[model samples]
Target: MNKLNVLFLTLSSMENINERGIYTDLVRELASRGIYIHVVFPRERRLGLPTELEIIDNIKLLKVKTGNITETRFIEKGISTLTIENQYLKAVKKYFGNINFDLIIYSTPPITFERVIQYLKKKHQSKTYLILKDIFPQNAVDIDILKNNSFIWKYFRNKEKHLYEVSDMIGCMTKGNVQYILNHNPYIDRNKVEVFPNSIEPIDRNNISIINNEIKEKFQIPAHLTLFIYGGNLGKPQGIDFLIRVAENFYKIENSYLLIVGSGTEYETIKNYIDSRHPKNVNLIKSLPKKEYDQLLRSADVGLIFLDKRFTIPNFPSRLTSYFEYSLPVLAATDKHTDLKNILIESNSGFWCESGDLDSFIHLAKSLADNNVLRKQMGLKGRDYLEDNYDIRKTANIIMKHL
Candidate 1:
């Protein structure tokens, strides 16, 4: 039998297939099973790079040049998103047009990829899978970035529905996400949508030797304190205002420290707060390289997740996988709508509180800080849960079934 060929469409910028991430891990797993994967991703203007293609371990990487899609002004971001489909289509035609793809998979952020998916499905007679990572226009509306049911909202909503229509299968991050989509968009076939949570290649931290003291000293992280880390995006959807409030009152947790990493539009908000208040227990890092961030993750005691309280859509942040990889307990404070709380309770992996509740967050933080035994137990459970449920093999198998 001929080796199956697959095309993956994504906005996530990945330069290599061996990078330790959800997408990279999944692609590597599929490639190991003798699938030829073709990935089409962005080369944003900020990088000053032309569209390029590279082949690694039987997998093809097509980097298409597009406008600034991340961490830019609203107007540029909007225009970039609107034009991405055409840019991607042109690049795909010029390069991979001759290849008869067996399956095509795409993820969401900009729902404007309808035309691209529609064209590919017809051209190659390929099966299409939609990885519903972000529920866009509604999520924007929840954060007050876009007005509900406005002209812009209607335009994107139509595009979103069309994207769903073209997809042969839809995979959501969690069960709550699955339900939310079915409830809002009743037109979608329920059987087509299923729980395909964000997953990763789980690493056993036991085998990795982490020089804790060196990492701590290098980053000026307090050696004695119970370190709590909030990594990933520092954006509006993360509920920056509430995160700042948590940092302001973080001193209430005895012998505990908070470290905020990653960059986004709301980065300066936290930066300004830290500069003005100079909170002793809270340290803010604008960003860190992937290697340095993983080093920091290994040294940290607890992982933190925060989502805006206003979201009606269930938003599952992928940072949970990073925390679980290092056996770090998760402490998430999100809106009541997300099923993160249920996952924490079921896995016995960590604790959760409603996003805006300061007392609950501090209480949970202090308990985890004071009790090393409890933290260790939860951390082990988290690692176990991650290996069993969110493994890359499971995700790859799901996509393979479609083929």
Candidate 2:
């Protein structure tokens, strides 16, 4: 018997495996089982950090310097995504060329890792796994960022197809994701696709009540009101305009408060609305550190999720797990295409409505705020659901079985 060696390539900048995130949680679980985890992540140009490798939490981390990929202009993001494959390949060769990996796992957003995967699979004879988190240029097209079937779209579409073709297994975030990939790319074998969801090592925050009030006081979160929070990325994908509408109409719901936390392209749009309008029931913050954000989650009564109604792909935001971890019920307003509504209904955890329906959101928001018993019941169910389905141990088992 031999200890497993896995190489994980991701676009997410994780400085430590102990950090709170889906990717970090999964790798931490693997490392706990005595597996050697090698993580290669990007060091964006904006950070001013050079390419370097360091041992963090018994995991090998290779930070490859690359162009600005996030929170930057469209041109820079495009160029960075285009060139990342070569940069990653060179980094992996220079650093871990001699080590033979048992498995190579990679995630999507760029969909330009075909060359690296092909090379690694051929060289190491290792199984390749594709964590299909983002559905590439199509998601861009859904949001009106990229024109459908344009030269740029076609190029990336081809890249996406090839990336799938090279992978030995495709792990999707949900069943909808699996079906979408199969339907869109008939060339792909359905047997290789499985539901590998956005999972995390859920913290037991249900019993921890020490800092709840202190954190509330620190953030000026009203203790008397039933707090509803919208955290994580606030970009176009989240339907920021719809969020603004929700904030504007939040006055209808009494004895409640809405807290919007995060930073993105639409941050200014939402900020301006909150600043100029000065909704007494709403509070907007740029962002918070993960530790503080987790504490803030404890003080919240409900979690808010919003998605653009135009998306054809089933986009599941990872923020749902954070709410579940803190035993907060979820209230989602998303496109009909996603299975989030079904999940919430089946789990008996929360409520959902179409993104554009302000009245429905208001009604649901009021109901959650007005009833304390209902909120606690739904929050418990959400925590149970997280333990049953979205735990990191389940993800580790699935990946290990495949390997």
Candidate 3:
């Protein structure tokens, strides 16, 4: 077989390439398999830094500096993303020059890459694959972020449709995701889209166990209670207000303890609530290193997944992989659209409840907290299911078939 060369366009900063992220793990796995890969990501903004190139784990990386993004306010973020196309185009011409890749793969967030994708596909005659992580304008509408019939909504709405039109193939995260795209976007050809669930590289879990009691002791995590962990970004999309409410409901439940890890826009909001209520059963942690975080995860009894009840988009958080990797049972409280509930039930791995229902979440949390044997059994099932289904190699092979 001829060697395949892939040029991936992602907005993930160069700073997070080594971290446990959706693209991070998959790109590492793909590079390890000896495929020729060139990745272009944003150069994290530092005061006098210039676009640079580096090689990491056998993959070539080009860090293209652009305007400040990611931690900035809304208007700045919009401007940065909207202008990213020019920056990326210049960097590609300067660094990659004339090196025709066999395939082009990109993900959606900015949705401003339509022009760049068009350029590469036409220039290299390459097959373009879009990892459609989430549906955009509609998702914004679902959360009341972008009002319909407005100028901003119209701009993004057109971009979203154009992006779908340009790609040779679109990889939706789930069957529900695929159905949603087809049903909502009648302009898209049904043949162009398929189910492409989120996947991660499988790890040997035999030697990995809950960390020694020292970690628990160091954090003052009570030994008598069932520890539930939620580690990842905490922001509006996660339903931060609802998360606060969920944490509040558990304050009086002595047997169930909640540990929330990481930070985001709503970090202060969550911290403020914790401060006000002084929930003795809840522990709040700032983000830690990937290794440290995994160790922390291993020490937990269950994983907590949350999604905003207002989301019409089938938002799937990659954090679920961390839970499965540690053989921890998951208790997911997400909006109704995602098909995760069925998958969880069929795998016999975990249970899911609607996001807005406190009673349902509390009931599930109490049941798991009350039964150690059931938690362990369900955790093992989740691990087995992860190995069989979410293995990165399987997902890579599926994408390769389209190439």
Candidate 4:
């Protein structure tokens, strides 16, 4: 067997490898499976470190400087993502100039990696694969961030198309995403797209048990109230306005309570709602440490997920992994475009409601909250579904097969 060299391009921060994350786990899996892996990602000025190389175990990671794109406003994010290319290109050549990579794997968010991908592909004659985590300009259009065919729209849209064109194959996060690409962009060959769901290293639940009262007491969460928690990015992409509407609907319900955690661009928007409304049944915690957050999930009764109704592109959030990891049942409100709702229904692991349907969401959420036996049954199914489908080992095998 020939030993293979791989280059991973991503926008994820590698500052803390000890903390578990999606991309880190995937790369680690590949490394462990006897694949030679090299990762490149941005290092912010806030870390106060020069552009440098770090090696962990056998995997090589190069951290280069880039603008603060995440956790910022729209204009800043645009500039940061676009400007990251030059920095990434320089770093790629500085370190990897002599090496011949077998496969170049990358993810989207900053589709500005076109030049680097094209450069490396030509140099090494490498197989390029895009882990298409997002479909951008259309998402921007959905959220009113960009006007149709505007200068900025044309720029990013062209970049998106070019990235697709350059990739040897495109791995989508869902079946809906695959179809969205093929459906809208008739120019793309149907053979180029396939489902590549977000995967994680499944957590051990053998020693875990519901500490019903301990966490509830500590957090001042009521013992009798059925907790419905949303514990990921709280932002426009999540349809915060609709989330506020959902919370408002349940504010007066005695048995149901809502817990909103995580922070993002729209954190202040959520914070203000909580302060002004001061609803009895809703608690908005800004954010929590990952360990504490895991503890909270283990204690919670239900996990909640949301996506903006306006999205024409299917968006899958990885927070579903945390819910499945704890054997907690989920209730998702999503746009029709994503088939996570379908998967949840098919697995019998959770309930789903259309993003725009407050009445249906309220009905399902209340029905699930009222039935402990049903919730427990679904939670068990969720664990089975996650293990069978999304285990990182399986994900690694899938990518390796393509390689």
**Residue-wise C-alpha lDDT for candidate 2, range 184-285, written one tens digit per residue:** 999999899999989999876546554458888877877998899999888889998899999988989998889999988888889898889998789998
The estimated TM-scores of all candidates read 0.98, 0.98, 0.95, 0.95
Q: Which sequence of candidate numbers ranks them by lDDT, best first? A: 1, 2, 4, 3
Candidate 1 per-residue lDDT, tens place, 11-63, comes to 99888677788898888898899999999999999999999999987899999
Score residue 232 of candidate 2 by CA lDDT: 88
Q: Candidate 4's residue-wise lDDT over 280-335, tens digit each?
A: 78888878887788888888889999999888787888998778878889999988
Each prediction's Cα lDDT score? 0.91, 0.90, 0.84, 0.86
Worst 10 residues of 3 by lDDT: 13-22
- Candidate 4 residue pairs in backbone clash: none
lDDT string for model 3 (289-400, tens) is 8878888788899999988889887888888877988899999999998888878898888889998888988888888988899999999999998888888888888777
Global fold similarity of model 3 (TM-score): 0.95
Error of 2 at 289 (Å): 1.0
**How many residue pairs collide in each prediction?**
0, 0, 0, 0
What is the Cα root-mean-square deviation between model 1 and the actual structure? 1.1
Error of 4 at 7 (Å): 1.0
CA displacement after TM-score superposition, residue 115 of candidate 2 (Å) = 0.9
